[model samples]
Target: MRPKQLNFPLNPDYGTGATIRRVSLRAQSHRVDAHLLDNFHEMRCSIVHDCSIVTAITGESVRIPTTACPAAVHQLQSLVGLPISTPIRDFYAGGIARHHCTHLLDLAVMAIGHAPRPSTEILYEAEVPDELELPVPMTIWRNGRLVCRWLVRQGAILEPLELRGRPLGTGFAAWASLVFEQDQLEAATILARTWLIAIGRRYRPSQAAGRPARDNPEMLGRCYAYSTGPVETAVMTGEKEAHLHRLQREA
Candidate 1:
């Protein structure tokens, strides 16, 4: 499917030999609009918050892997009455993530978290290399400035001795939180989320098109598409799940 046009400009060189993800956030006095684009998904979220509470929220899945994924956009309404005062990382811990699209929820929290900040807008770019085994750099950028870059291999940081051997998967944000604050904290969060999605680049979408999440043992009870009971049978395509299953069965 063709990607939707974004309101902001992107770095033309950002996509070279890498999977690039961009999150554009713009804010008014009481509303924040967020748009996300990457190789496998494109989504948008708008959060209307008063000084300290979210009064309204909406989300749209512009491009996604599965038909069921779009329904997660509606789950964003659940955040309508949530407090904006909650920390961005803590928002997901409140038990709202299990029934929502991870990316959409991420956008929602970002929009709400930054609503009170003085900046009118922010742009974040993350580039994860196609080849992780080589010494190529993985990077995260904020606005137009480079935030962090590292040589990564097998999900561990190889360069940047301070972060060497650090796992990029689970517990990354927690470790980053302890080491960063304010602007650094925000950058680390975006980088962590981007790394999660960038792995989708390893698989093509056609391998599992129109498959139900319930059929995949790895996906049961994971996210909105995989929610149990009535929704478990929803046609939810999963790229990583497809790849893993293929490797297991084909091997």
Candidate 2:
């Protein structure tokens, strides 16, 4: 089936925070004439347009809607210095990829106990290595309120090296809220882990059916690499839950 077009417009006023005005889709001429599936089902098989944009906005710095494809979502991952999944080849081309990816991250984070915080007073923080630079602007939010911002300063020193023997650029600055109670932190951690696991299961070449044999190597590599790091750390550390829950009750 030919792909469709989905458009999501971001509010021009960055001051009121980023807002999604609407999401609309259009089918290809050939596909328009063909019988179509429901929106939910069609999304599963179709190429979603601009899917990476949503993932890019939500994964690291922003907590927005989570609905994007795994590969496109991975491409949105600023930490990984890979190209965005090729539009034509990726499952869910267009916005569908992004929407699926966002949902995966959101689901994973929620699974860990990182519920949305109620206040914007908390400080959001993340630690990054001095390499594998972030190309996009980093946004900081507290209880859903935008607070501060930073961009990955290029020319920074590289410390960590990938398996490829290439020096990792400066690591990415993660987005979280400063006003989050301890429970919220725990929840967020859990949610992030869950999201990763979900993405890994759904998109990993080893798990997905119908993928070509030649495609296996790269997909496997990407899945393995994307699943590592902070999310893993969050999963390993069970301490955050109790502490966060207590903090939430007190709040």
Q: Report lDDT (CA) for all predictions.
A: 0.70, 0.24
- Scored by Cα lDDT, where does model 2 land? 0.24
**Model 2: per-residue Cα lDDT over 1-251, one tens digit each:** 10121112222322321111111122332111111111111111112123222121222212211121223334434312222232212322332333334333332222112112221222222111121224323333333433323232332222212212211121111232342344444333322222222211112122223322222222221222223231222211101110011011111
Misplaced by over 4 Å in model 1 are 1-16, 236-251
- Model 2 Cα displacement at 197 (Å)? 16
Model 2 worst lDDT window (10 residues): 237-246
The estimated TM-scores of all candidates read: 0.81, 0.22
Candidate whose TM-score is highest: 1
Tens digit per residue, CA lDDT, model 1, 1-251: 11122112233333335677788899888999999887677889999887888999989998776667887888888778878888766776755677888889989988987888875888887777765336657777777678888887766788889988877776776677787786777777677666666655554444565666455555555578767753555754543321110011111
Output the TM-score of candidate 1.
0.81
Model 1 misses residue 198 by how many Å? Answer: 2.2
